[model samples]
Target: MTVQEFIEFKIISFGDYFVTPLHIMQMVILIIVSWTIILISKQVVQRQINSGRFDKGRGKALFQILNYSIIVLTIIAGLDMVGVKITLLLAGSAALLVGVGLGLQQVFNDIVSGILLLFEGTVTVGDIIELNNIVGKVEKISIRTSKIETRDGIVIIVPNSKLVSDNVINWSHNRSVTRFRIKVGVAYGSDVSLVMKLLSDSALEHPEVVRTPEPKARFIDFGESSLDFELLFYSKRMFDIEFVRSDIRVKIDQKFRENNITIPFPQRDLHFKTSDTFSIDKTK
Candidate 1:
């Protein structure tokens, strides 16, 4: 072969053998770096959220933007290494892409709604939330979905669209204290005023109950045959709700026994009509 042709062949071979693998290695490194930044940023954001130091929405949104930006840059860098011009590729598919965009409307909605959720600061990591019947702590909020770890140790992934479209119960959104109501029934003849005093006192004595707002006992009504009293108190957290209610109930029972108040068991009266000719057939 001619000298120039031989040199050209060598250069082409060198480009394919060395340059390509080097590019792959570089892309791998870039991806690793981007992922590392995303993770670190998440931890930092979570710390700020749990500490109540800043608006959770703002912090999360900032981190999300940072994460996506880094990821996109990594992707673009990889594409550039392969000599695929992104601008030209996008321009070529601009029209067809518009059609695809219509099909992915829900996908875009979920992403946009997720951003709004983070920016609104209505929910945050470590916050207790009930979404689509999934109750748990906000573990991770991604662009399309947010993850929750329930009290029973189950992790759930709910689409951001669900959060936006449905009703969400955030127990620790504005404050840490969550209110729980206990309904108790007493015999109709029981003294109403005394029941109130007993319940309010019982709640105040419990350590889990909040004191500033003051424990409340409201006479809901005289149902079917008993006087219903509703006890309302703010618990330190929803996770402690069961323990608080159980303890308060024990306290109330004790107080009622001492004060001569009875928590009536539901009673139903029944009657039977029978003919005298009817008899049991034991032999059969």
Candidate 2:
């Protein structure tokens, strides 16, 4: 039943002061208003779920709005039922608002920032996000906070205000490609050109690595007894980035070994001198 109809039925049954015609009119209007709000909220939720246009951020905002609307409508309905004047409450609380404002500034900021984030399309649920050096996929966005699921399968709840104020990295925002640089050090005498070719072919052979960009092999620098070569390549966005990095290292080592590219070992040359007295006597 509509809120108005339900209230009318209750009033007739109760035989209270609300039984009067004026009271009946007010009750019916209040119920209708609340029902209208409920119906609209339902439609909004369904439409958002179907549309799939807004990212998780906007979707979450809409969901929160619907919840808040329903709550406000219920409050208004209850006040009307109990004969409390909302207008008077608004008037009497005018001075108190400033005091409450000072106390709840952070809360207000969170709510406002949550709304702004929804509209700005910064970080959305299902989008991989990196903020404050923590990498995770957004799981949920709420009024006061947001949830993120990291690769280690941990869930983190971060305040909404912090989300807006911090730098957010949306990994999957537009491009699903990620680049990683793997450094390989081979013996100084190793054929640098041959090493480059081997590394390139190894990267290309990997299914996850991109061939169009054509993994690049460049001489980075000279290390202690070895020459360092860097293999830069793009890969299909993998949730397990560390896995990709480790796998690339393993592949590079295997390839260098098979091709005889002399993966160098650290060596430091040392020259030892005789005691100072023996050296001085020999010089004399």
Candidate 3:
């Protein structure tokens, strides 16, 4: 046989569909072309991100959308090249898809949630979020899940649906800075004015604290053992807020010591009552 005839000779058949050397070559070429297109698209998206045309979170979402689109299109094209008609395949598997969909409802929900998160811009990569009392920074967002890195450097995989359905506090959303309060209690007899001044001064002394708004001290409540006070401050270090608070606390303690202010601990006095008949038992 001629080279052309050899290349075209069918090796296997499924119904009317035949697999041939020529067909295999065509499939290989199609895959290469699709991969090249995907790479080019990725490069363009990366350029946009690096150029500051889009913020990191938005850029990441866009890249994910583009990447998924390319993959889906590639799959469709690959099937078509292999002589499988997309419409016919879908029509034949319609019932099977329904059954699978029913079993994978949660999977579909996560995929939908991921799309919503990307489009709505509510939760995105690089955001500091609090969910179910777990506070972490979003590291990656995918079609079904997201990766969050906690303060201890532990990475947790969270379902996209959870992020969407649950109450999530996005600390870094729409603002670069957030307000945090540090609570401190001083002894009841301590000078209130001096305590307030010290709290304010300690916050101001911290480099991360914002200067414009100015930290203010509030006497929030009267406690049982000590006077409850809260120091409100704004800072840009959302992820490192715990450190900022600790530093301020240390400074506050040092200042209080210098000023002879005492932070009192909880104290309670217990009294014993003796009955008339039991009072004489002490002599025994």
Candidate 4:
């Protein structure tokens, strides 16, 4: 057979679809070109991130959008090369997609949530967030789910929909520093002024705690057992605030010990009333 005939010799044919040596070569070339484009895009994104041209979060979101767009475009191009009409294909699958959408409503919600999260820039990778009482640092934000790494070193995969629909506290959202409070109770009748000073000193001693706000000690309430005082402070280490608080507590406890300040526990007094039918015996 001639070279042209061999190139056009159909290896497989089904209805309107046919695969030949020429088609295989074209498919291979298309795949290689698509892969090269994706790689170049990734490199460009990495350079942008490293150069600090934009905020890391915003850059990452842009990169993801671009990457996905490229993949979609490449897929459409590949299908077109293989004699598949993009519009017609989508229209043909419209009813099937509708049926699938009903069953996969939650999955679709997560996808939309992911998109919103990227575009709105509400929650992003490396953000410290609280959801469902679980406080963790966002390790990754993907199309459908997010990976959160807690203080205990546990990584949890959370659905993106929960983040968008539910109430999530983004500690690192608007500000890098967040204010936190540690509640301390001392024995009643103890020196209130001294307690306040000690609490403030303990907070100020921590390196992570900010000083501009000037660690505050507030007399919040008079509890049943002791005098309730709250030590309020600001720190930039939202994810590691627990550790910072623990260090402050340790310092507070040591200072209190040295100052002979007593922390009280709950104490209750019970009295028994004796009636005519029930009298206490003196000698038993």
Backbone clashes under 3 angstroms, per model? 1, 1, 0, 0
Ranking by lDDT: 3, 4, 1, 2
35-86 in candidate 3: lDDT tens per residue? 8887887788779889989778988898788778877987897778669999
Which of candidates 2 and 3 reaches a greater TM-score?
A: 3
lDDT (Cα, 0-100) at 26 in candidate 2: 70
Each candidate: what lDDT?
0.81, 0.76, 0.91, 0.90
| Global Cα RMSD, each model | 5.9, 6.3, 2.7, 3.0
lDDT of 3 at 124: 83
Q: Residues 1-284, candidate 2, lDDT per residue (tens digit)?
A: 77666645544334333454446577677768777876777677668767876544556666666666677877777666656678987899988998998999999999888777666667666778888998888888877788888989999988888888888877777566767788878997898888888888778877788877788889999997889889888887556677767877787788878877787679988999877564456766
Candidate 3, 243: how far from true, in Å? Answer: 1.7
> What are the runs in model 4 whose C-alpha is more than 4 Å off?
1-7, 277-284
Clashes of 3: 0
Model 2 alpha-carbon miss at residue 183, Å: 2.3
Candidate 4 residue lDDT tens string, 106-173: 99999999989988989988889999998999988888998999989999999999999999999998
Clashes of 4: 0
- lDDT for 109 (candidate 2): 94
Each candidate's TM vs. the true structure?
0.74, 0.71, 0.89, 0.89
Question: Any idea what lDDT model 3 has?
Answer: 0.91
> Residue 69's C-alpha lDDT in candidate 1?
79
Error of 4 at 103 (Å): 2.2
Q: 1-284, model 1: which lDDT tens digit per residue?
A: 77554433432244434334455566788888888988998998889878988666557767877778788888898778766778988999999999988999999999988877776766666688887676788888888998988878888888888877899998887786888889999987898999999999999998878897889999998788689999999878685477788999999999999988888878888898986796889999
Cα-based lDDT at residue 184, candidate 2:
78
